[model samples]
Target: MTDTTAAPRLSVRTLVLMAVPALLIGIGSAVVLRALDLVSEQLMHFLWDWLPGQFGADESTPWWIFLILTLTGAAVGAIVWLVPGHGGPDSATTELGGPPPKLGAVPTILLVAILGLAGGVSLGPENPTIAVNSALAVAVFGRLSTKIPPALLVMLAVSGTIGALFGTPVAAALIFTGTVGALALPGSLWDKLFLPLAAAGAGAVTMLLLGGESISFTLEPMGAIQPIYLLQGFLIAAVSAILGIVAAFLFPYLHKAFHALRNPIIFTTIGGMILGVLGIIGGPITLFKGLEQTAELLEHPEDYSASQLALFTGVKIVALLIAASAGFRGGRIFPAVFVGTAFGLLAFALFPGIPISLAVACGVMGITLAATKDGWIGIFVGIALCGDITVLPLLCLIILPVWLIVTKAPELTVHPPEKAPAAAPAKA
Candidate 1:
């Protein structure tokens, strides 16, 4: 007798139906994110352009920049300290795709995000955008259909938001592959990604329509991978990874030190002052979220000396640490990419023989891997930025050794505070 057993399968119709909600969520997320970007742009214009012009103070002046950042810090601190939901958990404690905060906390999260983005905090919109979208997604999808799991909703929101953030579905898909691949569920990985990919595609398209910037850059295409070039790439990647590891190790201690102040206003304000000083040292070019700065650095690599590039790299790293640790609500990845780009440029400047694109790609790979603890996305970003496929094989090879260096390194996140030494016995 022959036994009749059937393999588990997903219904095409079910997946197709799910895509509808996913697309809608993607578009919605894009619109919300675009609106926030516009608001941030207007506020920044007022702070950096209008206000400075009115006072007859050079907007690029270090002193004026310092004052604005310090004031921005105080305002953000006030919101986090006095606002409801404490600005929705310290961003230092959250991961890129962590659990969402409650719906009631969404408004506070948005406020904090706006303050951070417009205030020149060295952070990105990734965390708050994802958090807000996740919260809204859960609420709306939950009411619409009891059949859809909360986990799926979160994935859709994350996929959609990240798609919009990077202005591409590829980044979202690469970032989520490892996440969903680990699940012990039926169906192929693509099967699980079906709805989320639909969402991501929609989000990416929506962002393009809104005129968001793409992360890709035009670089001289690497002709071929030479052995010497391979070794050079490896060394660059190794050094960059070490720098990232050092930052990761210091992150927790910095968080603890800031929190020891016991008041958000005090710590964040102090953080702002330090960041302002760093900004002055690094100059106005190093000030914002680093996306535009990265482009500037790449476009005019000849304008800055090797030492200047190195300073930009160091200052941005320190600024990122300070901003993230001192209760600022933002993501670290964007700033990390900037740091990586600077490091790459510095490497190219130091050693003129190696192709600039290859050096930059390695730099990006190493630092991004250490900072994000996600290998695939790091590699993707590196290649995407360079827009050179010939370097892909080299990057693939370089990542092997780089991953070994970073795999055991501490992630850049703060754990819950230790139980205050068990509260020493009451002094009767």
Candidate 2:
């Protein structure tokens, strides 16, 4: 039987017509994303700023961080235990751009995402936003037109959400290439991507209009490529990639360890306590998703000694591992970027003569590549964070060897074992 939900060879006319809904989806994605960010930002201020100040203690103090994170975890666990949809699929177990999530789970997922973000969990907003947008898009579009397959709608929603997240349609194209490339569609690659691209472009533009900020920094551009610097970039990227691979390899085991606690509330609460210790050890710099912290690290590299930078890198990696594993709902990319940034900055602080921007960009590229397992995004974000187009050619060449090692590593997601089937009835 022909499944009505399966994607067919969409005609050019049908594809073009789909753009209208795609555009709407993109706009809606941006709106929801913006709303979530704003709400999270406000709550973050309340928890990390207003409340701490009212109590006359610095928010970054060890005791305060410990209390907040532990409590946040307990609250989130309670939500997962009692809330509708159980906070959606655990972020640790799902791949970005994989299956469409249930629409009913959207609110709880967003709530936990907001808590994690505002509570200083070492994670990002990508997975949750994509999940919610994809869920809503599928539900709305499915009702509007049964002819459009759920996959098509999900692709559009993911493209739109990624575009908004990164503030560029280009990111949507590059990161999505591997996933979309496998479809044996009738059109050329670009033809296959046309509608999604439209949605991405719309989402980017909407985000820009809504005052989205791009990750950027001021650094002297790399001079004409130096042969010596090639080796330098390769070293930085390779080392950072190795760290990412280690975390990826450890993900599933850590997930099992956390789940062995046998209760969502208990495991999450314990995870929060561990994260608090990491925050105290790494200081305030290693908390959150690392976007703002990455900027801060770059703006004043001198403030962090090489040892402190090393601590930041190591702590951030561990924090990310625990946060993802212990049932926290968030993305891994931003924290990975933070780890790369600190490691890169540490290299510069120690050596003093290497091009600082190159070190940072290469470091970011390597880790992002390993973390995402996507070469295009790694290069793009490395360039994005460094804000230097001149580093692009060098990053391109440097990622080759690093990619080889990284390709064999497991993804930074978990695969919990399946349970045995129930016993057959004894009475016959």
Candidate 3:
């Protein structure tokens, strides 16, 4: 069976011609991602650091966390209400590589993304980075050549952004495998992938050159994988995925509830208050996108009790949902990663028998798969977190049951119901 959607096949020559453009797009993507990060970082320092010190308040205090988050929500809500583009569409209704926003909306999208990130919103930069890069790349490069279709340009830019965001082209390739597989163009998959990979590689290299951080963390070398580790991995991952499934089920309802307030400011402000409370409960560790926190967990596992790890896991899941449900503009991956890490650590702490690497890897694999419905990234992040190839074979098996679990469950996104066409007048 094959897809019937007809797409023009590109010759190797055309693909070769586009490779340079793809490479350029990749560089641009990395630059955009790094620029957003830099601006967000500076703003984060001001909001969380400089502002707190002036009042003789520590950022870790509940009052400060509550104040910062509430202010952020108000700020974002004001922009969404007043900004010309309204920060593009509702981010809760979007997905990674889903659709690009209008060119005019790119600036607003990037703006809100930075706001959410620096405001300690529990989300990542993936979706906005891709959204902005794809929009700009297509609008800019579409005029430069007719041979390259806009769709491919979107692909090239998305791949580049993914590469830069993850600090590796390999991550981009793994992520796009399903996308290419679903395309109807006739060619070897590699042929179809040529330009995108070029873009991804270029973007990855640019990010590396620009000192972008990576997602990888080193786990103490656990011994070779035992047969029992597979079962343990599956169990841990399954539990995590089940929790993710709960979030998936609640996603739409939560989104609907938040938007019920109508005005973005009111709903987002309330959401921020909820997140601030969650932050106080989970402490500073639960704030931000989860990369640095995840690394912190691995580096200092002894610092947290099992109950504390569990609290972190649960609080993060709620925070992610609220941040996502409310109109905060960002991706879910990083927050999910943090949740998965806490779950893994909690599992290891409780069992004491499961290998730390296996537990963490499976936890990441399960939760990510359920959270995003993307197994490739689940596997990529699971292995990347532990830096253990030993767990790869087991993650492959663990994903099977996890997929079944999420197969029928709703995806963690919302879709606005389509309006019925207006009835035409029967009388002339």
Candidate 4:
């Protein structure tokens, strides 16, 4: 009369088995999303540049341009009006926090993100890419309807998403896993250990075929920082943080103003005209949208005099704020990075005697505000952007003080609070 059916602890081999799917998801997602990114880039290049030239337009249309705007408007309007969950499944409830809704929404998010990017909105494709990938994974897994834990599903989805977006399974695994863990999701300690390793390896293998660099940026330290140089770096971080806070505050209001316009096509049309005028006044620094400007700022920091750099930085902040507000459909991460870099470059010129290393550090360190309220994201960015991993500690030291000063104001609340069954999550 004895029945012994106790729960079995996961063996090392068993844990590894769970990780296998995550690894596959990561690799598969990476390959697919990279292709998507390329496709988006080509389409954007054609629409924003080639098509415009062919049409002989003197200026580029607003990112929302296109007969598609009417289409986008009607489509989005319908989705908003009719789809019960068009807003999307609650991300906060889902554990990943604010991700795309439903497996079916993946295609919709991809289409919207690509169109938005092509329209030259000031956003990055990474977020939308992540959303699409996650949704796809969710759908595929959901169909199986297997008895797998939801926590495992979330981790796998995130792993897949990171691999696809960053092209570095390891970094993606680390960051995404950390993000999930920080959010207090499920999965035992054993699950955490093997999952990332497997996912990262898969991601790495995928990127090897994709041909883009696995890491986004690296850092190299100058070594043995003296006091004054340190102080200068601190100052640069401080100023950039102040600027970031100001940007955060302005973004919400601008977005509201654009939405208030009611009609999408006319609103977008007016938005384009307004941006064009700003482009004229601000010069090419405002053109090609944010990415081009970020590149120019990094390469030719000296080309911009101190005054010009300051003016350009301020203009970009406003430009991004307005672009996002006008329903341009881009992400803000790039603009923030670009603006931070510009500010750092300008600070070097203005302060004089500051090391270029310091400028680089400050530029990245300052923009961390946009990464998350936690502030450490900016520090990581400061070092990560350097293209040398060794510089992280130094970057962190300098960013700490600046983060403190800038955050002294009422903190900019960017993401909605974590909640279950919230409204629709954005594509990104």
Candidate 5:
């Protein structure tokens, strides 16, 4: 007797149905993002507290920071250069609707992120984390032979990513859902809305399992609020908004700088040199990664001398620009936040009477400006960076004028000006 066997098939209905469980899975994955956040935080703590002590490196010694800086620059450089598809998703583009890079690039991105962050590169783990999330999703589905829709998979992946990076599953879900909602899809609007919500719910669940916690910032204002203080706040916010636009305008140009360099080792090595020079001029605070540094700055505002803080702020921005120009793989978010916080700190130094809460607001505006090209999106970033969701309405009010002023600043566009059609040919 002969036996016949048939390969399993997936119908459109089956594929659509898969989205339900996928949403459930995505909620679970959000919890995973939280766990990853804990892991990364612990890793950062280990590096700062135990790793350096174990290796006999001390903060007082400039040499340790130098070694960290150079090695970090070199290691991340090598990883990006040697890795296929070069250093993960470009978060600059990805957050604004760029196509996801190949799933094959995941391992390389993970390795680069680990080494770079561990080595003290002034970058965030969000981009690499997102890459890994997508890759894992694809891998998991492939292994299970599941017939989940690709769109659903993407939703779950990004939801987990936002959950992990933000440590706020609700915000992550809302943002992811809102962003996806903005896109054009083949399915009904209900389906589009449903898929992202499902994924976000699952991602939040996953984040909880991964040990992620929501964080809040306590504001200790310098003194009683006054209209004058609000004016100062407006000024600071305006400045940061302009700066943010400038950074956005610079990104495309910076992209060109790296492309023009054309040699990975040379580009990155030279970037390291520039960073070293900037760090030496700026001081230890500006050397190596940014987010933790921003938190530290907030926690101990008195530790850094005014001049030192100012220098660090400038150097951080310069270093970030050079790093991107040199082809380093990292997200611009943390660096932007660091720079913004420094500016806020600087404002406090200048106007000693200003409330610290307002100062933080200024910093939030600055980060908002730089982190996103859209004013609406900047509202969310400002709220997120402030470490307080409650401040969003006030922030919205503050950001509105700042956004208007800065939006007209003529440099907020992410892409460089198109070369005027090559002079259209004196076509005669």
Candidate 6:
């Protein structure tokens, strides 16, 4: 009888060779992300600190925030209109795993991303940074070696960028599990994960070495998982998921409304002005992409009243929707995290007995799931932010009901307008 078993397709030598480029790309991508962070920090410092100081105005001056955001909108609008490739594709039209834009589009994408990040536009660097890294890797590797698969290059770039963003390979692995697990080809699931895991490990290590901080917080850990807490967590997540669904339904309509202007300059500039107004009302706490702000919120949860937290949540959701739909180049994850945190704090204020960490984690999971439509990532970020393992079992269980709520919810993506057919010839 013929042997039914088959040998492994990739030998150890071949695997090691593939991993070499993955490792290099991971480390290199992490360094680039760090550099972007530095540049963004400098710009933000200049805008919020030095510029205000020069005007003899404190950072709390509401007019300055308004003026800067309005101008930022105008600047971003100009870049989109004048720059080549129209500042890359509209972020609203792309998913996290979508194909990277052409290499030539990278410059404009980076420019707009930096502007949005530093100029307090209420967006995250996740989308643009990933796209940039992926495009760069695909171009460089495609030219250097035809042996490397394009899919592999994209996978490495995405995994590496995610690793750097989350400050760990674990997040990358969890995030990509659903994507990789569905592949029909390959051996075991780990076999498929081998190269991406290698890249993620390198990226995470490199980012840590460069002094990048992970999204973690030290909270009062749960002593033990309780049935009551699980019930509460499920309820909280369900509520948050409903809120997220509401936002998802609103997303496409808002996107279309903004695009109705049909000119990037008019629409983006106007969107920026509205964002500036929201920033003024919401204060400094509601501005920016929100990772640092989320930490601040957790550290001083008592400082904010229930009303303030509610306002923060509402304003942040609006900002996220507007920033994404109106030509901003960034991701929704960080901003969604902020919204989730605000809602969690609001819940805590209302119900003092419920554990704050659990409440916050549930909120994060629901909102992130709604925004990214990725359950594993949502749960991971939720647990990671609280720095608690005890909450994992609860989260894993709670995510089921939350998933049901969001599964059929409209996705937070925009469809581009179709070009009208040319008019019939006048002679006809």
Error of 6 at 341 (Å): 0.9
Q: Which residue ranges in model 6 land beyond 4 Å of their true spot?
A: 1-8, 181-185, 417-428
lDDT for 268 (candidate 6)? 90
lDDT of 1 by residue, 211-274 (tens): 9878889777778678898799999989998999999999999998998998999999999888
Candidate 4 per-residue lDDT, tens place, 307-375, comes to 887777777677666655654544556667777777877877877667665686677677656434545
lDDT for residue 39 in candidate 3, whole number 0-100: 96
Poorest stretch of ten by lDDT in candidate 1: 419-428
| Better candidate number, 4 or 6, judged by TM-score | 6
lDDT of 5 by residue, 1-428 (tens): 64355333445675467666666557645644454445555665675567678878764355655665566667667777776756775443455224345777876666666665665556666666666666667667745755554555656677656654555556554555446655444454445556555566566555655655433355563444455755777788888767666666676677677657766666666666666667667766665557667777888877777787678776787777776556565666667777888888788877778766677667766556645545554555555555555555556667767766765553422353446777554521
lDDT of 4 at 318: 74
lDDT score, candidate 4, position 285: 55
State TM-scores per candidate: 0.95, 0.94, 0.95, 0.77, 0.77, 0.95
Per-residue lDDT of model 3, residues 1-428, tens digit only: 78787555778776777788999999999999999999999999998889899998887989999988988898888888888888887778887777678899988999999998999999999888988998999889988887677878889898999889888898888878778866555677787777779999999999999999988887865687688887888899999999999998899999989898989889888888888998999999899988888999999997899999999999999999999999998889999999999999999999989988888998888889998888898999999999988778888888988899888887878886765557543521
Q: In candidate 6, where is summed lDDT lowest over 10 consecutive residues?
A: 419-428
* lDDT (Cα, tens digit) per residue for candidate 2, span 210-316: 98766668666677778999999999999999999999998899999999997999999999999999988988889898989999998888888998898999999
Expressed as tens digits, the lDDT of each residue in 1-428 for candidate 6 is 97679645556777788889899889977987888888989999999999899988755788898888888888888999998866787888887767888999899888888899899999998888888888999999889999887777888898998999999998889877778755433566777788888989999999999999789886777777778998888888888778888888888888888888978889999999999899989999899999999999999899999999999999999999999888888988999999999998898889887888898999899888988788989999999877888888899999998898889888878766566567433421
- In model 4, the runs with Cα more than 4 Å from the true position are 1-10, 55-96, 173-193, 213-223, 262-272, 281-293, 374-376, 388-390, 405-428
- lDDT for 301 (candidate 6): 92
